[model samples]
Every structure is written in C-alpha cells, then in structure tokens.
Target: MPRSLAGFTGAGYDKGRPLLVQALWLTVSTVILGRWWCPNSVRVAMLRAFGAQIGPGVLVRHGVRIHWPWKLSIGADSWVGEDVWILNLEPVNIGANTCISQGVLLCTGSHDRRSPTFEFDNAPITVGSSVWIAARATVLRGVTIGDDATVGATALVTRDVLPGAVVLAPPSADMTSPTN
Candidate 1:
C-alpha cells in the first residue's frame, strides 16, 4: 500500500488516482489488505490494494505503522526502520538511500485544540537523499530536511533543516534536574 492512517491524522494525493511511482508493488500482492508489517508478497499487495505507493528495494520491517498509504512515498533502496510510525496524513517523501532509523515517529497532522471545532491540521514532510534520521526522532508535520541531513536520535523536529546539516533537538525544559 502507498499509505495508511493511524495516529490522529490523514494523508494522500487527492483520492482515486493512479500513483506516479510504483514502490511496494514488488514486495507483496493481495486484494483488500489490512494492517500489516514485514509480510510476504501477498501481504504487501494488500497495502497496494489500499492505495499505498511503495518503491523497489524497500524493506518495511515488522511492526511499522504506516498511516496514510496514499500520501506516502519512499524512494528506491530506502529502509523504513522498525516500529516507525509514519503519519502520512499529509505527504511524506523519503529520498533514495535513506535510512529512517527504528522507532521514529513522522507525524504530519494534528488537531487544533484552540479552535472551537478542534479540527485536524495537515502538513507535508520532506526528507532529502542519503540522509539518516536517527532512531526515535519525531519528524513533525511541515518539516523539510535537505539532502544528506542527519537527525539525531530522540529529536523532536519542529522546523525545517538545511541540506547536509546535522540536527539535534534540544531536550524539553519540562524535565527537572535530580537532586540529592
């Protein structure tokens, strides 16, 4: 499948259109697939049936939650790390040869709590080529990391990053220092 929706969000190119790239078409095949991870060909096909646009040489390891299959794109030879939550509620682009490390949360949508209706918001995420998003990094919506950038582990990215840059999200100030 090209995309799926899970964590409080939704993503895609419009609806009911032929995908430009064929990604996971080779991973598996099925009719009306369901929530799955690291499955065989038929299992992968199930995602395709759900409108996911997977690429060649991509390895989606076990237990990765891909939300919004239709709005997601993984370039060739990209490895989506294990247990990664891809919030494709908006568009998420992963360049070729990139490694999205384990437990990374790519969140592209959120609710507007301040608004009276509490409606959902959308934003697209862009990852450049040859980049390595370290484990447990949260790539929030509307972020664009240029080519060759490195996102450190456990980083919470809320802004755009320049190409070839090494970024580290500072720890939240909420944490209090331990004292004797």
Candidate 2:
C-alpha cells in the first residue's frame, strides 16, 4: 500500500509536562542553555529545574539542545559535548562516565513507516556506563549501547552495541577513490 500523509497526527504520544512548563523550558533553553557562553553549572541547573535527573559533576556544554528535560537522565561525571541534540521524546538514560561528543544526536522518537497515519514509534535510549558516542553520530530510537562501547564519528546506530565494542563509520566514497 502507498503511504498517506493526511491526518498524520502523533496520537498517544505524551508530552510529559504541561504546556506552560514546556513553554517555559523552551524559552529558557533558547536564551540560556543553548548559548555558547552559558556556564556549565548554570545549564545543568536549568535542566534540573525543568525536571531532568542530572547527576553530580556532569558537564553539559553550551549549544546543546534537549527537547524535553524531564525525559533525560545523565549519570554522574558524564560529558555532553557542544551542540549535541537529545531529542528524547521518550526517556534517554546516559550512564556514568559517558562521553557524548559534539553534534551527536540521541533520538528517542521515530515514525512508523508501515502505518498510513505515520504514527510515532518512539522508545527510550539507553547508553551504558563508559560509552563514547563520537561527533555527529545519530543514535536512533530503542538502541541500548553497552558499557565501554565507542560509536565512531558520523555513525548511524540502529541496533544494540555490545560492551567494549567499537562501531566505526563506514568508509566514504571519496576515501575509496584511487589516488595518484
């Protein structure tokens, strides 16, 4: 059957907060947490104020975009790099000592292509302790990255990664070109 885009409302997806609170969070994140000059402490504090469960010594760099603070939980001593986007429509749990590099996208939301309504197929993302998701990598919904695993730059992670594993980005066409 062909896809239908009409009446594609995201039914049954919970926002996890009231409209007023969500609006307040949007305003605060844009004005303060998303700025390059915002202090890490202040940003963390703002996230906590918005209901995020951030642990001690967690470093959330500037320019980071968190869609819903209440759905996020970063363990102690973890580092969230600059410009990282956590689209956590569902819960996103990052374990302790993890490093999410710059521009990484930890997405917990996706659409059901099989459904004509294109309904939400969202699920939580779990990053085990000591994991490192490199720059610009996209971790899709329902992925559970194991402890000590390393996801290389620009990698697209759609499945679970075992502990101590390293998932590198596939070689680009330019990299395979014949050199003189």
Predictions in order: lDDT:
0.72, 0.96
Residue pairs in clash, model 2: none
lDDT for each residue of candidate 2 in 95-136, tens digit (9 for 90 to 100):
999999999999999999899878899999999999999999
Off by over 4 Å in 2: none
Candidate 2 accuracy as TM-score: 0.96
Q: Write the per-residue lDDT of candidate 1 for residues 17-115, one digit (tens) a residue.
A: 344333343232222233354354543455556666666777776667766566778787888876788867677888988999999999988765554
Evaluated with lDDT, which candidate comes out highest?
Answer: 2
| TM-score of every model versus the real structure | 0.72, 0.96
Judge candidate 2 against the unseen true structure and give its global Cα lDDT, from 0 to 1. 0.96
